[model samples]
Every structure is written in C-alpha cells, then in structure tokens.
Target: MITMSLYSEKDLDIELLEEKIIEPVNKTNESKHIVFIHGFASNSSCWELFVEKNKNHYIHLINLPGHGSKEYKPYHLIFKFIIDLIKKYIISIYQNYGPIILVGHSYGGAISATVTHELKEINENIIEKTILLAPYSKYSILKVIDKIKLFQIKNSDDFMELQKMIFVNAEKTVYELEKYLYKKLSLEFFKKNSKNLKWVILGMSLPSTFYKIDKAFKTIGSSFYFLFGEKDKLIDNQKTIQRSTINNIQPYFSIYEDKGHAFFAEDKDRFFNEIENIINL
Candidate 1:
C-alpha cells in the first residue's frame, strides 16, 4: 500500500494537500531514492504503475502546485511558486536521506529540468541523475501560436470545440481532462489569479526556458535521458529534441513508435524495462 504524508510551505496554510511515498516491499540499505513529479492536472496516481514495478527503489511522488490535493493559491509568479515548492520538499528529503534521482513526465519534466538547473548552480551533487519523459521544449513558431491562442477569446461553442480537439480518443483521456479542468479551474481562487495562470502558460510556451536548460545541461555533469512517444499530439518530439541541440544537451532519448502521448500507459512493460535500464545505469 502507498503511504501518505503532508508537507507545507509558508505561503500556503492548508494542510489537506498530501504527497504519497510508495516504498518497495523488500527494502534494501543500498537502494536509490527516486523522486517522480506528475505533469499539469495530474497527481501522484499517475506513477502508481511505475511504483509497483520498481518497488525496490524508494519512490517519492508529489502533486505539483495548484494541482492534486494542494491548496490553490493564485500568484502572478507561477514558476517562482513551483520552484519554492521544489526547494522546500527537496530540502526536506535531503535532510532525511541524501540526494535523489528525478524522473518527471511532461510538465513535470520541465520542473525537473528547471530544478536541476537551479540546484547545479549551488550544489552540483544535488540531483544524482534525471530523466525527462515527453518534456516540453520551446519552439519559436509554437510559442507564437500559443500566445495568439491564449489571448484570442472565442464564443462558448468555439471554446468547447477547442477543448475537444485537445483530447485523445482514449476514454481515460477524457476522464483525466475533466478531472484536471475541474481541479485547476473550478476553484474560485483560480479565477482571481487568472493573470498568474496566464503567465504560467506563456512561460511554458516560451523557448527561452529551454535555451536556458541547454546552457545548464552543459555545465551540470549529471546524466540525462529523455523519452517520448512518436504519436504525441501535444508536442512535436523531434522539434523539441532538435531545440535541445542548441545547448548541446545530448540525452539518451527513445521514442515509443506505436504509442501516443500516454505511451507509458499503452505499454507499461516496455516502459518499465526502459526505465529499469536507465535507472540501473
């Protein structure tokens, strides 16, 4: 069974928010600590299969800011809020154990990269290694398009139509989308902090962040790997990887040719094997 715990940052007072720590059934003294961060609108439940497969490794799964059970706070500084959360949780972990390996999915990958970059500046040994799954890299054209899409207000019909386009054919995809929208946008606090939410979207849509990541990768010596699905509808994996070339952050990358954005779910066995290879290395 997965264990639950609560953590806090001074900025947020509500303690109902929880982070789940799933431990391997057979623990070992020499096991490595691996931290997994879920993407936007996703909670730690996304890592349930991974945890089951790699129970031998200490897995720390967290719900990102403004998502999961965490309290909703609207701040214009979205990245700053996320970074603060990372710092607090990571420090707490380090205090109890040692440095950890990070595996992040989608937006979680962006967070992992950003945190690794920040940590490398002060302590090179903060993150033992990092893996990015279907990470977002900023491209000029896409950034421009995203900016245009964000500000362009449409009729309710058009908005609902666009939402449909965002989903995959999978039934689970619709369920996940509904849960995410409800969790993130349903809160009254979210409406009051709309500007911050916009900033979060715009910042994520910028290629500038990826460029910074490229530079940071060159300086940080930690091993990095990337995994993506060939049929990903939301992100162009090739373009994202190509953009990474700008900073020469050559990661060991693999593509699930037959899978979509939710490739891990499509074939957990293959995904688990690939992850085991990376982790054991």
Candidate 2:
C-alpha cells in the first residue's frame, strides 16, 4: 500500500530522510512491505535489483544520511541519529502497511538489528522478518593489515582492492560497475563527506553498539536470521558464530561456502532464491 519512488533523485524535505533516492512507482494493493537498507558507503540504489525482482510488492529503500545523495550534516555524525531515523520510518510504515520485512546488508545490518531490538522493547511486532547479510557487528574478522587497507583508500587501486575484499570474484557487471563506482568515490563529493562517513562507521562498531545488537539477535529469536558467506574476507562465519556462543546467544544463520562478503552482488539469482525461501518460510 505504501512505496517510495525508485526513480527520483529529488531531495526530500522530510526529517526522516534527506532526499528521494528512487523514482516514483505505480502503487500496488499488497499489504506486505519489504524495506531494504544498504551497506556502508553504499546507497539505496544497491537494492535496485531486489526492487525490480519484487516489483509487485510494496518496498521501501532507505538511504542513510551522507550516503546516496544525502548531505552530511553535523547530526549525521551520531550513530543514534541513524538508528532513530530508521526506527521512526519503520514505525510509520507499519502504521500504513500491516507488517513488514526488514533487510539490511553489512553495516546496515547492524543498524537494522539494533533498531529491531528498540522496536521490540516498545512491543512492536510489525517486523515479520529481519535478514542480515554479512553484517558488520563486533570487531571484524579481517586481519589488521587488510582492515587498515579497507578503511584507508588513497587511489583507484585502493578502491579496487576494497572491491576485491567485498566480492568473491569481480567478473561480469561487478567488474564494469567498479570503474564507475571508483570514479564516484574519487569525486570531490565523496572526499568531502569521507570523514563523516568514517565516523558513522566507527560509531556503529563500538563495543557498546554491538552489545545491543547481540542482545537484539538473542531476544528477537528465529525471526532474526543471519546469512553469511563462509569465504567472506571481512566477516568470518566461524569466528562470528563463535563470538555469539561466547555471548550465550544462538543465532539463526546460514553460511554460503563459496561466496564472499558481498555474495548477493556476486550471484543475485541464487541470492534472491535464498531470500524467496526465507520469506516463504
């Protein structure tokens, strides 16, 4: 019943989100809403494939402040600003649509999980499912050297190197998109906002931050599921699960043996099939 335009670049004056990241779409009668949150340094457009694949369902793609076309304001530096903004958006969506599914990738996954926990405290059962893809919660499994390389990108070569860390293999469209993505990342726009973006990431990775996420995953039960790539360079499936065990949490998760951190981007068809099965289940 509610949908955000998937084709618009126009800035939105709404306090929830700064701009319209997608173009307007034909309204559907479906009551189910699928909300997607993209990863760090990524925009709502990352979910364009998912949107196109589920054109018939109501969908909302959230663009975090400073990501997409959003301007980086002083308040955007705080992690709570993002978590609260998305929680407010989700509540508003539930008021219109009956219930919704929340999906987040990487950093977005951490935010989504925390927000879901906050919602649960208020006794809101509007989120039918929460799917996290290679979520960046707690300290990363990446080695110190590789992690440093990922955070500090000085050139296109560095950017491509980061891409390699994200994807299992950079063949097909992934290869083509990297050039264009690097160009954008190298622009003055990205340069200006880089500090704020990095701050947001650091804020999200705080031990206090992920403690809440772990609690959320534990309490939310099976409705909250984690899907990770066993071969992921950024997040090690075994280490992540082992950490969860240490926290006395048993997570509902799956590990794709041959995939990497951005497995969905690598093999979308198979990814969507997995998504379809999760939603159907």
Candidate 3:
C-alpha cells in the first residue's frame, strides 16, 4: 500500500513520480489491496475521507503523473502518457501485491475502469472489484460551463487567476486540505506545462470514453459499482441522458436523486457509507 500527501509543499519535483506517488498504508494484513485514484486537477488528498473510513484495509492512493507536484514537462498530448504510467504502476503493484480492489472519482473513475478493463482482459482474477463514482465515459464534458468558467490560459498569471477562481468557487464544498492541494495542481501545470487547458482536458477525456468497456462490465463484481447523481451537470449532457440506462447492468450502478457531480465532497457521510458497504461486502 502507498500514500502520497497532497498537502505537502515539499519539493516533489526532485523525485520521478514513478518513485513517489504510490504510498502503502495497511488496512489489515488479510484485506485485499484497495487502490484509490483521484479526479482531474486533483490529487491523493481527495481520498482523505475514504482513507480514514477504511483504515482497516490495505490502501493505495495514486496521485497521477503531473499532479501533486511541480515537475510536469510540456507535452502536446498527455492522455496516453498518464494511462501508460498508471498501467505500469498497476502492473507493478499486482506483481508485488496480489488481487486488488479499485475506487476512483470522476476522471479517476474512467482511468480506473480502463485500467481494470485491460488487466482483466489479460487475467480476469487480478481485479477483485471497481467502484466508479461519477465516471464520464462515452460522452464529452467540455460543455459544463455555466456555473464554471471555461477558457484557455495565456500565461502563468492567467493560470494563477484560474486556480484562484477554482479555490474560491469550491470554498464551501471542498475540504481545507484539498483546497490547497487543488491550487498546487493548477500552479504546477501552469509553471511547468503549457497553457492549453482544453488540449489537456481533451487528452484526458477522449480515451477514457473511447476505450472498449465490455470486459470492464464483465470483470467488476456486483459488490463494486458506479455511483452517479441525477443532478450532476457534468454528466447530464443530452447524449448522456438519452443512453444513460444501465438496466442490463443495474447491479453495477447506484443513481442518487438530488446530488451533483461533487457528491463525495458534498456529503461525506453518504459517500463513505457507499464505500463502506462495498468494502464491507
């Protein structure tokens, strides 16, 4: 199990993320290795609540490449880079550890799904279960702009302002520790990477949706499932709503009525309850 403290202002650039992001924390000696993947522009700190709740299980919090640090090198397309990095990490973990369980939020969920899909295709028993929260696959989230501003940054100053706005906007919903961590993600990207937010976002989103998922559906157990809010603006797109039925796979999802995309942050008790139920099962 591994843990990366997202709130630390320590020099994360010194170490390659391959050597730093995975932190091993013991849930219990006999427990299945449980992994947590965070959302876009987010870090491992986002799972603080879940980590605290599942202290008895072996836990691994993954801070994806270019996140929780200031070491990003510019890349025209980083989508594949991130997936490949995670895939390598997962492979390594499986070799050192054993069968596993996965929990992910938002974009992280998509990544978890895709990674699990690949692993299962290779060896189905390696993946125990996957719990995806508000994962967006098969649709683009570029249009969720009314409450949030959507534009590219021109320079570092513009990027800082954007980060400031996000911190301000999420002031009420986000946790204090995570608020600071989010700021770091934006700043690191601006300082070390390019100003093309759209390009980065597209790179992350497109492949998650385009990847084949039939195996993902077959591999994940009913104990693990997807959680989505009917009110989530990000996934409430026209196409998402029309083909949103998961009737054939109802056992794999849980739809919340009034919650939004930030359900975990918005209601920790409810979110933790869902996670506890799955892990407990």
Candidate 4:
C-alpha cells in the first residue's frame, strides 16, 4: 500500500499520477472513503466544492494522466492505458483503506463505471457504490459536426463558448475560469488530449466502437446512481435513460431540470445532497 501524503498538485510523479487524500478531521470507522475521478481534460481540482462539503468522509481525489499538473506521455493518451492506471489506483486504495465508493463526472463517470464493473470480477464488494455524474457513454452520431467543433477552440472566446455549453448559469464564474482555461488550452498537453478526444469521438461513429461502448454500459453488474443534467449540451440525457432502461442494469437515473454538464459546480449544495442521499441508501 502506498503511504498517504500531503503532496501538492505539481509534486506528482508519473508512476502514481496525482492523488490527494483528505482524511476527515473527525474520522470514524463508519466514515466512508469516496474516490473522486474528474472528467476529460479536467483534473481533481474540479471537486473543490465537493471536498469542502463532504468533510465527514475521507475523500480521494485523482487526476487522470495528462490532466492537472501531471506530466503527459504518449501512452497516457490511450484509453486502455488510462483505465489500467486507475484500476491500479483503486486496487492500491482498497488494499490500504478497505472498500470505497466512487464518484466520477463526465469522462471520469464512464471510467468509474468500467472500473467498478471490471473490479467486481475480483471482489464484488470492492467498490461499495458508484455515483456517475453524466457518464459520457455514447455520443450521438447526428451531432458529429458539433462534436468536431469542440476541438476547434482557437482562443478564449472559443473556450468561453465551450463553457457556455457546460453550464447553464454561473456566467461570472465561467468568465473567471476562462483565463486559466485559456492558458491550459494553449498548452501542448491540452492539444494532445483534445486530439485524442477527437479521434475517440470520430472512432465512436463506427458501428463496432459504438457497440462496445453500449455493451460496457449494459454489462454493469452492480446498481449505481446515474445523475444527468437535463440541459447538458455534452451528453444526451434521454438517450442515456433509454439505454439504462433497456439494459435493465438497475442503475438509478436522476435528472436535474435546468442543470448542464457541470451542474455540480453550478449548485454544490444540491450535488452534495444527492451524493449524501445515495451514500445513505
């Protein structure tokens, strides 16, 4: 088991990527350990509000390779390699801390589900529960053109335009974050990750990749919470509901009426309450 430490974001190494463990001030045996996984092109810092609100639980925040301050490598762009690294993190965490609940957003959501399902083969109870916030399972082939436009971000205006799609409100917050995102947008690693996403999105248009993506969602053996923002521009909530229903995977689907992709950030209280309710259940 890797020793838990207080390492800053920039201090992370390639071997372990980046991890931040926030142990509850009032730790108890009943205090659950919740591992958080951020979405594509995002790092663990996205869960700042989440960490602040869930002070009763031991929180594990992980930044996917190439995201956050971690050094990016060519292999890190491969989806399988990303999954393998996360799997290792989960296993190590379990070995050191026992069972955990997983909370993942967007791209991280898809990964959380996959990791949870795959790990169940070894120990069905390793992951106590998985709460997926808008898992990016299957992209609509009809929106191929729009999805293509996402990678064409050339400046801050384009990034803000993208942010507009991510949040329904929070104009001020988006504006503030724009400066940071604009800088990240110009970085080589960000460009590479964007290119990787483009290829993945285009590849999903193929029948074979589409089937695999659907199959993954269909095969989740355990019950989980599938939270979706009704107004989310990045994912089709209705299609996600349809697939979940048809598969009978037994996942609970909760749709927030006016929320967008990053609704958690938009309304941290509601998001935290939802998580609390799920964990209690």
Candidate 5:
C-alpha cells in the first residue's frame, strides 16, 4: 500500500522533475498546510484574496508547469499533471505536516479532485478537507467554449471578451485581472501546453471523469465539497448537478445563483464563506 507519509523519496518519483516544479513556501509551522493550485493559463497568485485571511496555516502556492513558467515540461493530460503535482507537493508536504486542506479554483479544482482521489486511492489520511471553486469535475467533449469561444481567442482583447461572455456580471477587480492577464497572452501561450492537448482530446472523445479511475468520493462521504457558479458557461453546473444526483456523492454543492465562471475571483465574501464552511466542517 502507498504510504501517506511524504518527503520520502522511496514513495513518490518526483526527482526527475524537481527543477521544473515551482513551490513557494511561506511563513508557517509544520502542523497544518493548505495547498493552492491555480487553473489554466493562470499562476499560483490566483489565491490572492483567500491568502490574506488564512495566514495561520502553511500554504503551497505553486505555478503549474507551462502555465506561467518555462521551467517545467508542458502537461497535456489533466490526470498526469495531477499525479505529478501530488507527488511533488501533496506527498512531500504530508511528511512535513500531516493531512492538508486543499483549495483549487477552475481547472485547478478539477486537479484538486484528482489529488483527493489519489490520496483516497492509498487510503492515506493526507487530505483532511477539499474545497473546489467552480471545478470541472468530469472529462467532457470539447464544449463550445473550448472549441469555439476559447479556441477563437485571437488576442488579449478576445480573451477579455470571452471572460465577459462567460461571466456576465464580473466585478471591477475581476475585470482588471482579466485585462492584466490578457496583456501577457501571446501566440506562444496557446502553443506552450499543446503537448498534452492530444491526451486532453482523447479524454474528451471518451468517458473520462472520475470513472476513469476508482472514485474517491465513493469511500469518503462529503470529503469533497464543491462550489459552482450558476452562470459558468465553460463548466456547466447542470452537468455537475446531474452527475451528483446520479452518483449520490459528496456533502455539498453550492451553486451561486448570481455568479459565473469567475466566481472565485469576483465574489470575495461568498467564496471565503464556502471555504470557511469547509474548514469548519
């Protein structure tokens, strides 16, 4: 059986990719940890607002390889990325502290689910709680956003427009963030992570979600808590709701009626409340 204890080289194989990984460690003790993973095209800084309130726990804000840095090789399939990320951060940190509370936004939330699934796989008490903000829980065929609205993004302006379309009512701060990140977008940004595009496409062609592997939520009731915005066009809450109903999984799924794809960044009070609720649970 795989051990939950981390920082042991014998358990996880991450040495070959050490140089490529970027883990930002901040001030904290060794008892508790909160690992934050950002979504597609975004960096670890996605935890901007939540970080301020939760300064007590140790945090691992990582820049996913190929998203904001050129240090690591690009990942194509989401599963491979999740595996490596767990090996690099989750496992190692579990050794330092114990089980951690994981918070992931957007695609990061999907990645977070995969990590929880992994920790569950080993029956390892490595994840005490999980908060997924607007996560894409399953593998879906490329939707209109991925194929059209997302693929049609030609420049920075187009990217911002896409945000407006998906998030009908975003706050000024979220808009500012969109504009800022858009400015950094370039042709290379799209091509950079294309290596794993093949696997992503394959995932879309087939049934991929949690069924691709033994589901973690199956064993652990309510360990995985989900938060979705009602208007999120990119990741439909309906599918999540449907999936939840069909499977009878998890403890909570808070679908904010007024929010959209950018719910985590746009709504501060609600986002923190959901996370705080999970922490308290």
Candidate 6:
C-alpha cells in the first residue's frame, strides 16, 4: 500500500501523497528513483498505474500548490514559489536517497522541465533525467488568451459553462466532467487563493514567459524524453517533439496513436512500459 504523510514548512503545508515505498519482496535493489507529477487540475492519483507497475523502484508522487491537501493561498510569486517548494523537497529527498529521475504529465511536464532547469543551474548532477509527457510549449499561449477572454465575460454561469466546453472531453457525462474539473481546480483552493491563482494562470499563459523556459531548456544538461498521445487535442504533439529536437537535446520521443490528453490514465500498460524502458536504458 502507498504511504501517506503530512508535511509543512512555515506557512506552506502539503500532503505527502506518496505511493508504494516498500522494498521489493524479492530483495533486488532498483537503481533509479522516479518522481511523478500530475497535470493541471489533477492530483497524484493519476500515477497509480506507474506506481503499481514499478513497485520495486523508489517512487514519489506529489500534488502541486493549490491542489490536493496543500494549503491554498495567493502566491503572487507563482513559478518562483513552485520552484522553491520543489527545491526544498528535492533536497530533503536527496539527503535520504540521492537524485531522482523526474516524470511529469501535461502541466506537470512543464513543472518538471522547470525543475530540471533549476537543478541543472544549481547542480547538474542532481537531476539524472527528465520526461515530459504531452508537454505544452507554445500552446500555453492559447491558455493565456482563454484566460483573458474568460475574465472579460460577464456572467459567472456563462464562464463556467464555457470552461466546461473548453476543458472537459465532449463525450464525458456531467458527473465525470465535474469530477475532472474539481480534481484540477480544487475549487476550495481557488476560493482561498483567488488572486494568486489569477496571476499564475495569466502569467504562465503568456508566450513570452514560456519562451524563457525554452531558453532554460537549452542550457540544462539533463537528458530529456518527450512522450505524447498522437491524438492529443490540447497540444500539437508532433510540433512539440520537433521543437525539442531543435534544441540539440536529442530527446527520446514516443507517440501513442490511440491515446489523447489523459494517455497515462487511458493506457496504463503502455505508459508504464515506456517508463520502465527509459529507466532501464
């Protein structure tokens, strides 16, 4: 069973939403540590399959700020706050176990890239590798535009309805849609940290700001891998892979033909297999 713990640092408090930490029953040691980061509006539960499949390895699952059991407060600092929080956690983990291989899904991918960049700047050897699953580069601009457009609309009901149209998959029922949105938004967190949420949503959406991240990727020396669902509706998977290629980073890329935005959740076997292959290689 996955272990659970609560962690706090001054004003910030987070639930250690971990999964499967026991040593293997067979007594073989796994060399690599894997940390999974879920996408926007989602929590650590998204990585249940990977955790189940890779029970032998040291696996860590985390919920981002303003989500899960973490305290929700407006953090005007945005990415800086996230980076600092990750740095603290990484350091704490390293004290016990060594560096880890980072894996992130969607928005989590973006955070993974950012964390790798920061780690590379501080200590190139700390982050062994990073995997960006269906990451967003240029597409973040679309979200920024959507935010602006959303803020301008008059009625809250209309805005909420439109949000549903944009984010929720068309085939899902209302209950599923609500669950999906609630998981991501953690509406209570939003209510508590409304201003910070606004700044982060708007700030991250900007193309110019995202470009800085691209520049950071260029300088970071860690090996990178890109995996995406071929049918992802939110991002141009091919374009993202191609863009990563231009960096001369030589990332391993995989496109799952039958999957979409939530590929990890939709096709657990394939996702876990890809991860195992990456780690073993």
Candidate 3's C-alpha lDDT? 0.59
Clashing pairs in 6: 41-184
Work out candidate 3's RMSD over C-alphas.
8.2
Q: How high is the lDDT of residue 40 in model 5?
A: 59
- How many clashes does each candidate structure show, in the order listed? 1, 9, 8, 0, 1, 1
Say which candidate scores most in TM-score.
Answer: 4
TM-score of 4: 0.81
Superior candidate under lDDT, 3 versus 5: 5
User: Model 4, 1-281: lDDT tens per residue?
Assistant: 88642333333233645788898877877799999998765677788777777767999887776565544545454555566677777888898889999998877887787788778778887899998898877664454346558555666666666677788974765655554563464344445566555544443344644454577677764467888888888887777767766655667878888888888877778889989888878
How well is each residue in 50-88 modelled by candidate 3, as lDDT tens digits? 666654566777566556443454442255555556666
Predicted structure with the largest lDDT when compared to the true one: 4
In order, candidate lDDTs are 0.63, 0.68, 0.59, 0.72, 0.59, 0.63
| Per-residue C-alpha lDDT of model 5 across residues 1-281, encoded as one tens digit per residue | 87452233443344322222223344534335777877655566657676656644566676555455444432423455445555556777778667888877766776677678776667558888887776655532344335443534457666566566456564465455654453455344655544434444444334445453225334434777778877777776666555544566546778778777767766767787767667766
Candidate 6 per-residue C-alpha lDDT over 26-140 given as tens digits, one digit per residue, 9 for 90 to 100: 3455667777888655567666556656655777777777445544555522555565677667766766788788888876787788888877778877778888888756654
Worst 10-residue lDDT window for candidate 5 reads 15-24
Which residue pairs show backbone clashes in model 4?
Answer: none
- Per-residue alpha-carbon lDDT of candidate 1 for residues 216-280, written as tens digits (9 for 90 to 100): 44443437788887777666688767755555656688988866666776666899998878878
Two-way TM-score contest, 2 vs 4, winner: 4
In model 1, the worst 10-residue window by lDDT is: 158-167
**Candidate that beats the other on TM-score, 1 or 5, i.e. the better one:** 5
- Between prediction 3 and prediction 4, the one with superior TM-score is 4
